[model samples]
Target: MAEPVADQNSALPDSPPDGQGEATEPTNANREAAKYRTKLREAEAKLEATEKRVNALLRAQVESLAAKELSVASDIFDIGGASIDDLTDPEGNVMSDAVDAAVKALLAKRPGLRNGSAPWGDVGGGRRGSIPDAPPTMLEALKFTRR
Candidate 1:
């Protein structure tokens, strides 16, 4: 019988350079890196969602506090014949003047109310000082009904 040939697949001292084991290190590293990237993205998404929820809660709380303060202020000023709506004019109606004066007085006495201008104003001229044109009379408003 012919001598058995050496198993060509076995590692041998004289193996050709091109016949070395497969270069799996690069591929393995790439797979591991991709997995890490995916996990990082997921973590970032979760953090963003949490931040959004926190922001929403904060906004809701602030709104609630502001509404309560507005209601209390309305009750206090109603005694002086000043309503909230009347104090929102450009030229500063009587009620607006009263409210401004009251705010200033409170700021002087308490020192904390001086954080900024009172939330009362048609400031910036966007919708504050501009007057709404008068609505048409009943007859004019109903002109379309006749046809």
Candidate 2:
């Protein structure tokens, strides 16, 4: 009532039995092909995941490092609100001596900036000379007169 399957080894090409057209044994090459395909898929998936992890880590590290560097720079250069208030006091009665000292210190640190006169030279120091009488234009007011 049932048909018997031929043994894999006994199914030779030259001696195929009746009802069997040809020997069709599963070969090592087919099995190896399937195994390699599975391995390739697994490797591609792992590579994608590793790339995602590395990108995320690098992004986080860059942001954290930038924030840290900004914090350090702020600590180093932040002059604070009080210093600005002191510098902006309008009256000539303000503490100009301290401001002058700070400017001199900065000029000393950066010697290249000392080529010109101080910004407050005209305010505190007496006028260098008298303006010429009957100054014709605004440009004439800026000219230095010999004492």
Candidate 3:
């Protein structure tokens, strides 16, 4: 009968280097992992808070631009179901061209939101009738006295 040979695959597991035991190695590794996980969580939380602030600032900028250029209320954007992303580029910067396009689209969809100013020059309260060529009353005669 042939003698059985020890295979490399069946050999004993290697021991930790430098006389360190396996138990202490795992504990140290776990502690480092836990520390890293805690730091990651904190960083993620700060990132989330920063993103919220950025979105708020971007929204404010959109509203202010809409009010100034479109002469419309901030609600106009909401009415169109448009979000901040629609008004911004990939870099999160507001694009004036995009804003104009969005406003145009909204105006087209809702004509009532047109930037019609207050009844400016003359709505009605001005002169009523045409001036009489022949000076009907004495008040008209005062014009000749001043000349």
Candidate 4:
């Protein structure tokens, strides 16, 4: 082994070694447990309330859509010159099948109406059956003699 360097003896520790110190405990650990539990309960209650409101909102949306559909069906009935109330049963409710049938018949009669186009109009077909014929002219009565 090599001889010790001159100043290495002075570098060695002069005092005894110190032991590891005790760990510090938090001051209010037990006191805050109840408050944290109550905060969690409040969050859960808010979640449940929000869930119930969402369900109610969905129900209202469904009802509004149903009413709008019925109004559309009523408009279809009116197009064929019949009111929905007149076609209703004794119980005062319109049948879905009748609404379906009326809309189908109208669509079949006027296929273009469904595609946002007007149906073709019929040209006048001679004179109407209700009107009487015009009397003969005075000149034709005197000049024409042959049978």
Candidate 5:
């Protein structure tokens, strides 16, 4: 069959020549909404992080209380296995290292309670000699004044 000739009589719609359609510029309202959405996302992320930190702190507190109760009930505290100082939050507050606290408690009732010196075996050589229970730090030594 012979192909029919196409119709050229109808006019095309009076619109912009479609290359790519016109890029719509964002309105001020659209820009403001986008800004608010970004801010909301940031706020959500910040809230999530804060919640995690708060949960950690609460868990630590619960653990601390449990440890104190266990120590006291087991006579560890009474027998100087853990001191009141150990049960408390230490200065500068490393959040409750239970093992460290317990060890401090155990060592609390030492020669310092009496007028006795520490066992020489605490230092090297295990020989019978008295040493200061706590040696001075480097900072303390540096402060020495010898005229």
Candidate 6:
């Protein structure tokens, strides 16, 4: 028996219908939306980096201002729980008046934070005695005896 011939006018199983094939091509709206999404992501990342830099600068300014009046600025940052925003204005500029007020308030509350105030006694060798005029011999050194 002979095999039957396939018809040329019939649609193939692997190919989509003629009118529906246009859907496979991307539309201008889709391309524009993708472009905007990429731009948005880049903008968000840049904003985050800028915020980190601004916060670091503000923190340094706060510490420098505090250091001028106090021996330990970390004590104020740690104990007072102060934020960088507290020392800076809405425009991200350091507010010297606010910083001065904060330092004064902290010093009033913690008198010890003031500069030139020693927390402990002077650190030195405890009552060191004068050494002998002559150097000891190796044998005397090995003896471990004190003058």
What is candidate 5's lDDT per residue for 15-131, written digit by digit as tens? 455543333335655889999999999999999999788656654554454344343333444454544445445452434566445535554644233213324454455557668
lDDT of 2 by residue, 1-147 (tens): 778988986775565555344333455557888999999999999999997886555434433332332332121113221242343345422344544554455445544444333355446566677776874776655564532
TM-score of each: 0.36, 0.31, 0.63, 0.29, 0.32, 0.57
Segments in model 6 whose C-alpha atoms lie over 4 Å from true places: 1-22, 25-28, 117-147
Pick the TM-score winner. 3
Q: Which stretches of candidate 1 lie over 4 Å from their true place?
A: 1-22, 71-147
lDDT of each: 0.54, 0.48, 0.78, 0.55, 0.54, 0.80
Error of 4 at 35 (Å): 0.9
10 residues in a row with least lDDT, candidate 4: 18-27
Report the lDDT of model 6 for residue 89.
87
Candidate 4 lands at a TM-score of 0.29
What tens-digit string does per-residue lDDT give for candidate 3 at 1-147? 998999875696776667688758888999999999999999999999999999989988887777643556575466877788888989999987777777778878877776676447766896799887875678867877898
Error of 4 at 108 (Å): 22
lDDT of 6 by residue, 1-147 (tens): 989877875654555766355465566569988999999999999999999997887888788888887888766578666777787888879888888888888888988878775466757847767788899999999789655
Ranking by lDDT: 6, 3, 4, 5, 1, 2
Worst lDDT window (10 residues) for model 5?
A: 110-119
lDDT of 4 by residue, 1-147 (tens): 998687965786554335322222233554587789989999999999997886555434433332333334334544655453544566645555655566566667755445333345667767656654677688777677654
Q: Number of clashing residue pairs in every model?
A: 1, 0, 0, 0, 4, 0
Using lDDT, give the best candidate's number: 6
